[model samples]
Target: MGEFKPVDLFATRRDWDENPREAFRAYVGSIEFVQAGKRGKNGADTIRESSAAVYISMFERFMTWIETRNRSFTSVTQEEIKEFLDLRDENGKTRLTSKIRMVYVRLLERAYEHLNVDSNPAKNLAVGREEPFRRGKEKAKVILKVDDIQRLMESLPAAPAWNENSKNKRQRGWETRRNRALIAVLIGAGLKVSEAASLKLRSMKPKRVDGKIEIDLEIWDGTGTGMKHTAVIEQFAVPEIETWLRELGRMDLPSDLVFPGTIDTADELSKPTIYRLITKTLDLAGINTAHSGGRTLRNTYAAQQLASTNDIGKVGEKLGHRERRATEMYLDAAKKFAEDAV
Candidate 1:
C-alpha cells in the first residue's frame, strides 16, 4: 500500500467555522482516493459520491452486522468479508442491494485507519464489477408548468378526501388556510418538502419597528432537514407568506411543528406523504402525471426564477447553489425565447 495519510476526522470543527460547509463538501468531492487494481473498480470509487447521511447510516448497520462474528473490521479475512458482501439476505432473508454493500466498503475503508492496517482487503474486491444504482433521472428532473401550478393551488381546498364537510366551517377554513400557506411558502421559499414540513413556531419571528412589522425567519438546521441553500434563497418573506406565518403563530404550541407531522410532531413530512399530497393535488386537477411531487414543484420554482432573471450570479446566490455552474441546470434555452419573441 502507498504511504497512508492520516485522516483528520476531528478537523471538521475548525474547518466548519472558517468555510461554508458547502465549500468543504465541494473540496471533499474533488478528492480522488487511490485503490489497487482489484476484481473491479466498483467499491473503490463509490464512497465519496454517497451522501454523508447515507454513509453514516450504512456504517451503523454494517457495524451491527459484523458484531455477530465478534470481528473487528481489520481482523476479518478477505474471503469472510467477500462472503458477507455476497450474501443476498440477512437473518430474515431481507435482500440487500449492491449500493448498500458499497457503503459497507466505504465504512470499513475509513475504520481501517483507526486499526492501523497496512493492507486493505476490500480495496480491490469487485472493483468495477457493478454500476451504481441511482434514483430515476426522470423523477429527479420533473418540473410543473405554470398552468399545472395554478391547477395544483386551486385544487388544494376542495380535494375531496381530506376536505369532507363533517367538521365545523371554521375548522375547515383553518385547514385550508394552513395548506395554502404551506404550499405558498414551499413555492415562494423554494423549500424542500422536508424543510417546510419540519419548520417550528419559534423559527418565525416578527417584530414591529417604526410602526411596520419586520419578519425574520429563523430556520432550524437540525439533522436531515432543510438545506442552507433553501434558507438563503428565501431570505425575504412577503406579506402573503407572513399571513400564513401569523396563522401558524396563533396555535402557541412551542414544541409543535410549524407544518405538523402526521401526528403533530416536529418531524419533517415523510417523502411518501409529500409525494402522495402532491400527486393527489395534481390528480384532482385532472393532470395526467402526478407521480413527481415536491421535486417537480421545486424544479418549477427554480426554472421560473431563472426565466425571470437577467443575472445568473444573483439567481445562483438566491438558489443557494454551490456555484453558478449548478444553476445552469435550471436555465432555459435562450434560442427558444428568441424564436418565440420573433
Candidate 2:
C-alpha cells in the first residue's frame, strides 16, 4: 500500500493490518487526529499548525519507540504507554511536564478510540477522566513484584519434546535453549527489545571473566541517544546464557546473530515472536498481569539494581541512562515497593 495522499487519508479502504505503516500515515495525516484533538480537554475546535504538529510529533515519537521495541499499536498496553513517556522524558533534552504528559495520555486514548482497538490502555490514565484511576491511583504494571520475579526465574518454560519431532529433535533442543537464553538475557541484561533483536555473537563474547560467567553485554540505545553502555550479567542468568551459547554454536547457522529467526535465515525475531515468548514465560510462572512484555523485565532489572545499590544514579548507569532524571521514576517505584514491604 502506498502513502495515502491528501484526499485519500480520510477513508479506510482496506483493513489496517493490510498496511500498518500506511495506516499510521493516515493517522498522522492530520485529518483523523485533528478531529480527535478538537474534542479532548483544553482542545480548540480549530487547531493551529504548530499545535497539530505537536500531535503528529507525539505519534511519530511514540511509533518510533514502538517499532524500536518491535511492538505494534495493537499490541501496546498501559505499561508500554507509560514506559514510552518515561523513556522520552529521560532521553529528551527538555523535561515532560505533568501537564504535557497528561496530554500524551489523552491523545493516545483518543487515537486508540478512533482506531477501534479492543481496549484503550491510555484511557483514564490521565487524572482528569471520570474513572477509578482517573485521579492516577491505578497501580501501574511497570515491574513484576519481587515474588513474581523469583517465580519467573524458577519457572523457565520447558523445552519442546525431543521425540515429538524425531527428524528435527536436535533443532527443538537448540530452539528451546535459544528461547530460555533469550528470556534470561532479557531479565539479566534488561535489554531493549530491538537491542535484543540486533544482538550478535561477538557482543556477548569475552563471556567469561576470570573463569566465572560474567557476560559483558554492550548496548547502544538507538533512536538518537548515541550512547553505548555495558550491562554485566554476572550470576543471575549465567547458566541459561551458557547453555544457549553452546546450542547456538552447534546449530551451524550462517548468521552471526545470537537470536536468529531460523537456522537457515539471518532475520531477527519478529515483534510478535518476542511478545509471545514473554507472554508464555509469564504464564509459565503463573504471574497474572495485563501487560506481559520485555519492559516489565526491564523494570524488574532496574528495581533489582536499585535494591542492590540503594543509589538511583548507579541504577541509571546500569540501565544505560545518560541522564539521572530519567531514573527518578524507578527510584520512586523502588521506594514505594520498599514501603509496601515495611
Candidate 3:
C-alpha cells in the first residue's frame, strides 16, 4: 500500500461551492483507508468495488439532497442528517430499509474524518425505525416519474436538417445523433451504461412491426449471467436509434461499437465517458434526485415496465436479472407511479 496523503477535504470549500459533485468525488477517492476496507470471510467478506459503491452512493445522495434544495453543505448538522435519512413518500412503506439508512450514517462518519467540517454529525446518528412490512434490503432506486421522462425525451437534441452542410453543422449532427441514441438505449431499453457502450452493430436488430420500428438487443453478459438475452428498445426512442445507426454507418469506422469510444478505430467507449454523458444529460433535463449517471434512466425503464405489465418475472428477465429480488428493487417506485395514475 502507498502512503496515504491526508489533505484537508474542505480546507478550501469555496473551490467546490460552485462544483459540488467534483469536490465530493475528489475527497472520497483520495481517502485510501476507505477504499481498502476489509475482505475475506474473516473481515466482513466485502469486495472493494461493491463496498465502495454502497458508501459512495449514500454520500452522493446526501449531496444531491442538499443541492436540490438550494442549500449548501457548509454547515450540515445532525438535524440535516436526520432530515435526509428520514425521507419517506406518501404510503410511508418505502423500500429504504433500516440497513440502508444505517450505512448512510456510517459513511458520513468515515467521510467527515477527512473533511474540514466542524463536527461529525453521523458519529452517533440513528436512521430511525424502518416502516412496517419492509421487504428484503436493497438500494432504493431513484426512479424518474412520467413527467420527468417526458421532459428528458423532449430535451434530447433533434436531428439536424440536411441543408446545413457546413463543417461545424456536420460535426454537431453526428454528436446529436450519437448522444440521442445513447440516451434512448439507456432509458428506452434499460441496458446498463457499460452494456450499452459495448453494443456492436450486430447486437442491434431492428424490425418493422406493423409500421413501427423496434430494436432487439442481443446481450450476452448483460446481467453477468453469461447466458444470452434479447431485450427490446421501446418504441418511444426508435427514431433516435435509427438516426444514430445512419450516422454510424457513414463513419465506416474500424470499430463496430454503437457509441463513440476513446478511439473509434478500436477501444469501446469508456465507462467514465458514458457516465459523464448521462450526468450532463440528466442535469439538462433538470433531474437531481439521484446520483448515478444512467441509473435513473435504467430505473425509469424498470418502473415503466412494472407499471405496464405488473409482472415481476417478465420485467426481471427483460433487465437480464437472474433473481426476482433484483427486479423487486423497483417495486416501490413502480407501485407508486401506478397508483398515482388512478
Best by TM-score: 1
| Window of ten residues with lowest summed lDDT in model 3 | 218-227
Over the stretch 1-342, how does candidate 3's per-residue lDDT look in tens digits?
A: 133234355436574566655555555545443453333224442233444444556667788887877876655778877788778878585435455665565556655644546766776563233332243345577777788777788877566643334434235467666877888788888888767888888777755573334344544421123234666788788777876786676666788788867434668778777888787777888877747477778888998999999899988877877678778888998987776666
Off by over 4 Å in 2: 1-141, 160-170, 207-226, 337-342
Q: All candidates' lDDT scores?
A: 0.51, 0.66, 0.67
Candidate 1 lDDT at 244 equals 52
Kindly provide the TM-score of model 1 when superposed on the true structure, using C-alpha atoms: 0.56
Please rank every candidate by TM-score, starting with the best: 1, 2, 3
**Cα RMSD, each candidate:** 10.8, 12.5, 11.8
Model 2, backbone clash pairs (residues 3+ apart or across chains), number: 0
Model 1 off-target regions past 4 Å?
A: 1-58, 65-72, 75-108, 112-140, 159-176, 205-240, 262-268, 332-342
State, as a TM-score between 0 and 1, how close model 3 is to the true structure.
0.55
Which residue pairs clash in candidate 3? Answer: none
